[model samples]
Target chain A: MRSDRQNRTPMGLKIAAAAGLAFLHLPLLLIFVYAFTTEDKSYQFPPPGLTLKWFAVTWNRPDVWDALTLSVKVASISTVVALVLGTLCAAAISQTRFFGREAISLLVILPIALPGIITGISLRSAFNLAEIPFSFWTIVLGHATFCVVVVYNNAVARFRRMSGSLIEASMDLGADGFQTFRHVILPNIGTALLAGGMLAFALSFDEVIVTTFTAGQQATLPIWMLEELVRPRQRPVTNVVAMVVVLVTFLPILAAYYLTRDGDQISGQGK
Target chain B: MPHAVTFQQVSRHFGAVRAVDAVDLEIAPGEFFAMLGPSGSGKTTCLRLIAGFEQPTSGHIEIFGETAEGVPPYRRHVNTVFQDYALFPHLNVADNVAYGLMIKGVGRAERAREAEAALEMVKLPGYGGRKPGQLSGGQRQRVALARALVNKPKVLLLDEPLGALDLKLREQMQEELKALQRALGITFVFVTHDQGEALSMADRVAVFNEGRIMQTGTPHEIYRRPQTRFVADFVGSSNVLSPDLTARLGGPRQWASLRPEDIRLDTDGHHRGRVIAASFLGSATRITLEIDGETLSVLLPSGSAVPEPGEEVAFSWSPGDLHVMGDEA
Candidate 1:
């Protein structure tokens, strides 16, 4: 009806949207193009020639494999810690009203709200003061500081949207506290936690600022990429690794978006 | 047998607000009891107290002769149909109905069979596979009812279950709920602000106001002989005649209630008034009149003559119809 006509976006707005998307993605397009370029040192327009040799070169590097292993381990461990701690914090804050609840919620999310360098420097100084050596565990702890915040943000929003009556209904239907949490609460928040965990993994995988401070002799993928850029060793190989990093991070983020877009579809809301 | 629920001067307070003030109540077993009131009138709080979602701040509560205080909701033999239905969004209809049985460690196949039976009882036999989101509002309401009833709780607490349905659906559900209660013979403690639902469905209705029960009686007794001004005014539209007007009408100088439908217009009528407005309501015409410095409403049958605005008319009711109300609480 008339709503279809009213919903038609203007040509100007459509052009603006397309231009905005292009502005953000065109640089990433360059990375894809250069990964196949034959040039080994400097970036060039249209790439003098396109070849697939960089992929094989990147695959052969032992250093690349080590960095990839470290990144996956750190991201996986950090995501696990974040999932447990973040869900606990979200459940406590969202389900109950107590003194200083708002302040506590703000403090939980403070690591992400502050500048990345600030979190990095504070974590480094704290570890040094405690006479602790920078190991893979240090990188995981640092990544977890912010990853927990990401998971907390997603979880708290979902918990607040969930109806309190659902819990009451479960309890009234003879479910104990543990049973209610397992059956009613877990299923309701399952997708949100999955999306949150994916986002946390993606964030920790590429996090370079804190990793630079916390990693002693270790090289995560991003730190390795940084070293490759500075030393200029088979430049297209770095681009090829960059292509992997983009895909590894992009798939989870895309999955998170799809998971959360239909978040308000909880059935029987306000019925 | 002991009553299904009993409240001995029970109250629930939150800081300075007494949400459910000290009040006593009793619900006989197998009775369809209704707690009717406007919002914040403590009807829902009372229902929650019975369901064990709420504990009384002071005083004792008993369920089937057992102590109710300090008992968790899961330990109580009661279930509730929440106002919003509260069907599990992640679960399909069959799983939602079988949630209680699942918690009790029922086997998968038996759970599915019982869930199907519960759905069939609610007249939704083949709807077990569909998700709650796919069903309409009324269908979700029935699913909520089925989910609660499948447990076979000693008492079923309903919190405004029909509040969200359209008029026709609400009326239909009300009859179905009444029939279900009668057939199951379980104590039903229903909470609602809709007086019509309470009047039409409950075996006994408790009218609540300001965290206290104004009156409790059979619907016919409540309609014909409201004991207080609040009950008379709230239960249905009635002309609450003050003591001054009662004296003018040759009744004792006491507060009285007169039903609109009880009065008849006739040439030999003694009481006279000027019609201020008249509105047609399909079956009857509601005539507002200015009588002795007070406004009174009278309902005339649709086929009867309606006096025009500003015209004089006389109406009278039988002496027995002029109900003298008791003193306020």
Candidate 2:
């Protein structure tokens, strides 16, 4: 009876699952389809025609290049910051017992749990009070607030799953604190940090809500794409840029998924 | 000569629970010693104290006559084979074995040679390149053993290292470990809850219960003369005769104990019983008898004519077999 329950899914549940997946991905599919549509200014039930012209148009645009470069730079910097801070936070949270440790962990994850607009507005206000003018660094900082949460989530889960005996054994086998960290702890946590960093890079790459608040004049690719949507530029070109952003963001997330999927089978410390 | 390891009035308390309390122990150099106990019995905690992984709450621990207080595990001249092996999964067999040599700043080439020698010592000569995940339970145990031994420390600590292996493999490893300890001529302090393992391998055994040492003696002495009820029951099975029986048959002692093997059935001897139950073991038949309304177990050799349940029989034991116990019994 238990096995039968697992094997047979109700039709309603199957339909709901499919509907949920379509709700998420169908819009992204439409963006991909419209990227090659010949219609430059409007949408149609089916593309009246198709062309390779948008690819050329997007390639030649210097604004696109600048925005893409800026987004890449911000994501890269934010991911680096997230990796360092996130792993340290995870190590501290999991490996130690102190008062308010749970509270600190909750605080670490609060930024991501809050709506992006709230984080963006708060960062903007903090930057304003400090008299700090918005720049590339401000955009990077805005994205890093959430990026750290992503990295920390991945890292702390892995940290909790890891066996503490590995560290103790290293010390017992004659490794000092530094040696144990270097040889034992680091290797154990390395792949989790990598996956977390890649995920952070993806999250920062396509982020628009926070960028709009922190980025004053400089436009990241997503911000520039938002501008193109408002103005009467080549509509297909906007879709083409959207395609680039999707691929850029999607690949890392896919890689991160695979990294974490295989991560469950850690280097086996037990028989 | 100074003892290899000594603990004087050691106590370790966590919050309100005494994980290890007022324990005093001494191990001679090159001794194959076993700390035997059930889980949460403080055997592992005592081993940890000697390795400097844990500190005494209010007493002294010495290793090779040097105070172990406040000393780090890495600084202490000791190494451990953790119960789960704890071989670094990222490293292959050789690299795991060479971890200590690398930490000591030995040159890479020299470390490699020693690691190879260590692997050979553990009888896994060609397995240097295989990851720990590729090895079986017994092989991983050997790797962990070699990893600790490579440092040539004065003392080696094993925390239930064979707990994961199957019965046959556990027995094999027990023999191999005993032989290895003899070959190395280094003090080995091993923790295990298996009474048979302690009896078959250790030169001396310390029985722990409830964060306290119950007794320490050679396996023969411990089994033949358990001082406390815990030792009698934990180290090996024993039957504690009732107070009435002790007063009648225990001569002058306040309490009396007898091993099951010591109790014999003669069918013609003085004491009489009706066999209440019988189990056919491979080498011996376990016979449970009701004698004078109290239960007594006897082991009769297999292939002999065993009395059926409800059959009346006679049993007897020599005066020397009635081992006495303290009030703690």
lDDT of 1 by residue, B1-329 (tens): 99999999999997898989988999999999999999999999999999888889999999999999999999999999999999999999999999999999999999999999899899999999999989999999999999999899999999999999999999899999999999999999999998899999999999999999988899999899998888889988788999888889888888999999998988799999889999999999999988878988999998998889999998899979999984441
What TM-score would chain B receive for each of the candidates shown? 0.98, 0.97
C-alpha local distance difference test of each model: 0.91, 0.88
Model 1 residue A264 lDDT score: 33
CA lDDT, candidate 2, residue A80: 98
Tens-place lDDT digits, model 2, residues B1-329: 89999999999998899999999999999999999999999999999998888888899988989999999998999999998888888999999999999998999999999999989998999899999999998999999999999999999999998899999998888989989999999999999999999999999999999999999999999999988877887776787776666665535546667888887788677788799999988999999988778888888887778999999998888878988785547
- CAPRI classification of candidate 1: medium
Ten contiguous residues with the weakest lDDT in model 2 chain A: A262-271
Q: Tens-digit lDDT track for model 2 on A1-271?
A: 3787799999999999999999999998999889999888777759999899999999999999999999999999999999889888988999889999999999998888888899999999999999999999999999999888888888898888778788888988778888888888888878888778888888899889999999999999988988898876588889989988888877877777777786443110110
In candidate 1, position B181 carries an lDDT of 92
DockQ for candidate 2, please give it: 0.71
Give the clashing residue pairs of candidate 1, or none: none
> Worst 10-residue stretch by lDDT in candidate 1 chain B?
B320-329
